[model samples]
Target: MPVRYLIVDDEEPGRINLRLALADYPDWQLVAECDGNAAARAALARHDVDVIFLDVQMPGETGLVLARELACLCEPPLIVFVTAFSAHAVDAFEVHALDYLLKPLDDTRLAHAVERAAAMLRQRQREAYGAALRDYAVAGAAPYPERIGVRSVGRIEQVVVDEILWMEAAGNYVELHLPARTVLHRITLNRLEALLDPARFLRVHRGAIVRRDQIASLATGGEGSHRLALRCGGVVPVSGSYLAALKAAMAF
Candidate 1:
C-alpha cells in the first residue's frame, strides 16, 4: 500500500531537495520527477501516480493550468503545491490541493502534508476532491483550458483551443484542424472531447468534433446522411444519433 508520487519542479535543485525529504517517509515511493508541467503530464500518461508535488510557477504553462486540466481527468492524482511564492496559496486551495508547501521547505510542514495525503488516500477521499474540482469550475474559479499540450518531436506543443475549427479521428490520435493547418494531437477523440468545454464544442459524428462558432450550415444528403460546412470552408460529417444534439447546440 505504498503511495506512488511524482515531483514536478522547474529547478533541478528544488526537485533534488524534495526527493531527499520524501525519502524519509518509508511508505512513499518516488514514481518519477519532471522539470515542468508538460513533462509531468507525459509522465502521468505513462504511470498511475497517486500524488503530484507540483510547483506553481513554470516557464511556458503554470502548474495551476495543469491542475485545471487534471481536474477534468477521469481520475486525477492528489496535488500538493510546492512553491516559493505564498501568493498562489488561495488559488492552490481553490483547486482542492492536498496541501500547499512553500519552498525552502520546513521539515515539520512537509511531514504534516505527507501524513495528510496518506490519510486521505487511505480513506479513499478522492471522490470528494473530484466533486470540489467540479464545484470550482462551476463557481467560475477555474475555466476550461484555453490551450492544450500535445507531445511533438521530443517537445510539447501548446495548441490554442479557440484556433481549432474541428477535430477528426486519426487512428489512435486526433487531428486538430485549424484555419490554415492541422495539428496531430496524441489523444483519442473521446478523451479530448471530455477535456474541452461542452458549451463550445459539439460532437457531430463518431469521428468528428466541431466548434460551435465554426458551423456555417448543415447539409443533408441521400439515405439520411448529413454534413456540415464550417466557416473556414471545411466539412465534417454528422451522424444521425448526434444530429438532434447538434441542432440543439446550433439552436436550430
Candidate 2:
C-alpha cells in the first residue's frame, strides 16, 4: 500500500520543497496540504494520512498545538516536523513527532523520515490485521491475555503476566513487581488487575494484588492484623477489609 502524506506549512516554498523531496519516492502519495492547523485538521478528517510533515512556527494556530491534539488521539499518524529553527526540535519530539527535519530540506533527512514513517505504518497495519484474524478465529470467544503492551516514553514494551509476582498502586500509575526488576506502567492498578486471571491472581488489599502461587506464608501483625510473605521474600499487608477474603482463599 502507498504511504499517504499530509503537509502543513505556512510558506508555499516549504511545501513545494517537501513535495519535490518526496516525489522521488514511488510509494509516497500526497493526500493534502494545508497552510495552518485548522486547515490541517480538516484535511486530516477528510483523508487517511500516514505521515504529517508539519511546520512548527506558523501564524495563529501553531503546528505544536495540532501535534499535541493528535497525540491524544486513539490512532495518530506519524508526525515529522519540518522547520527552519533547530531550537524547536525538543518541543516537537515532546509532542511525539517521529522525526524533526531542518528547513531548506535536506534530501537525505527527508528520505530517512519518510522511510521511518513507512516502516512504522506497516508494523501497525500488520498488528491490526493479526488481531482481526485472532478475533475471527475465536468467533467471539474470550481468551485470557498472556502479555500486556505497555506504552512508555518513546517505545512500547510487552510484559509477560506470569513473570509478575505482585502489583501496587502508584499515583496515576501501577508498579509491576517482577523477578528481575520493577516496571512503572502508565495504567491504573484496578484496570490492570481486571486483565489478569482471577484464579491465578488475588487482590489481597485495596492497594495491592499478588499472584496466588507467589504467596509463601501468612504472618501475624499487631491487634490481629495479618501480612503475606511472598516466595520472592517480599511482604504485603492484608488490610482488615480484605482479611475475610484472604482467609477464605486460604481455606481457614
Candidate 3:
C-alpha cells in the first residue's frame, strides 16, 4: 500500500510547496490538503492517513495541540513539522514528530523527512499486525475490551476499563478520566461509547460518559438542571434528554 498523507498549513504557498516536494517520492500519496486544524481533523476521520506534513502555527489550534490529541491513535500518523520558525523545533520533537523542516523548504531536508516517515510507518504497521494477533487470541470471551491501549511518543500504555471514571468529548478526541490521570484518545465520544460495555458505562450528556458505579449522587436544581456528583469528587452535567435513562440505569 502507498504511504497516504495529508498536508496541513494555513498558507497556500506552504501547502503547495509541500505538495510539490512530495512528488519526488512516488510511494507517498497525498490523501488531502487541509488549510487548518479543523479541516485536518475532518480529513483524518475520513481517511486512513499514514503521515502528516503539518505546520506548527495556524489561526486557531496550534499543530502541537493536534499532535498531542493524535497520540491516542492505535497507530498515529508520522508527523513532519513544516514551519518557518525554528523556535518550535523543540516542541515538535517533544510530541515525537518524525522531523522538523523549516520553510523556504530545502529539497535535501524534505527528502530525509520523507524517508524517516516511511521507515516509522512500516514499523507501526508491523506492531499493529502483532497487536491484532494478540487481541484475536482472547476476543471470543469478551466482545468489549477490558483494557484499551493509549499510544504516546514511543510507548503504548494499557488503561483498564474499570479505572475510567468518566469520559469527555473534545473535538475529534475523547478524554478518558482515570483516578490518577486523564488520557486523550483519538476517537469520537459516540465511537468510544460503542466500544465500552453498556452495563458499565452510561452516556449522561452529549459530551460526557460516566462509569455506572461512580455515580455518587444526582443533584437537581431549578429549571430542570441536573448534575451527577461522582465519588471521585468530580461533577458532570446531566442533560434532560438523557435524564430518564440515567434514572433507570441507576435504579432510582
Looking at candidate 1, the ten consecutive residues that score lowest on lDDT are 88-97
lDDT value for candidate 3?
A: 0.75
lDDT value, residue 73 of candidate 2: 56
Off by over 4 Å in 3: 1-133, 153-155
Arranged by TM-score, best first: 1, 3, 2
On TM-score, the candidate that comes out on top is 1
Candidate 1: regions farther than 4 A off: 91-97, 137-252
For each candidate in turn, the TM-score is: 0.53, 0.50, 0.51
Reference-based lDDT, each prediction: 0.77, 0.72, 0.75
Per-residue lDDT tens digits of candidate 2, residues 1-252?
A: 898899999999888878888889998999988899988989988889878888989999888678667755556676777776644333224222236788677888777676656765766743432232232223213445565545444344556778989989987677889999998876667666655689889998878999888877888978987899999988998998877777777773
RMSD of each: 15.0, 12.1, 13.6
Per candidate, the number of residue pairs that clash is 0, 0, 0
Candidate 2 deviates by what RMSD? 12.1
> Lowest summed-lDDT stretch of 10 residues in model 3?
88-97
Clashing pairs in 3: none
Q: Which of the two, 1 or 3, has more TM-score?
A: 1
Looking at model 2, which ten-residue stretch has the lowest summed lDDT? 131-140
Q: Supply the TM-score for candidate 2.
A: 0.50
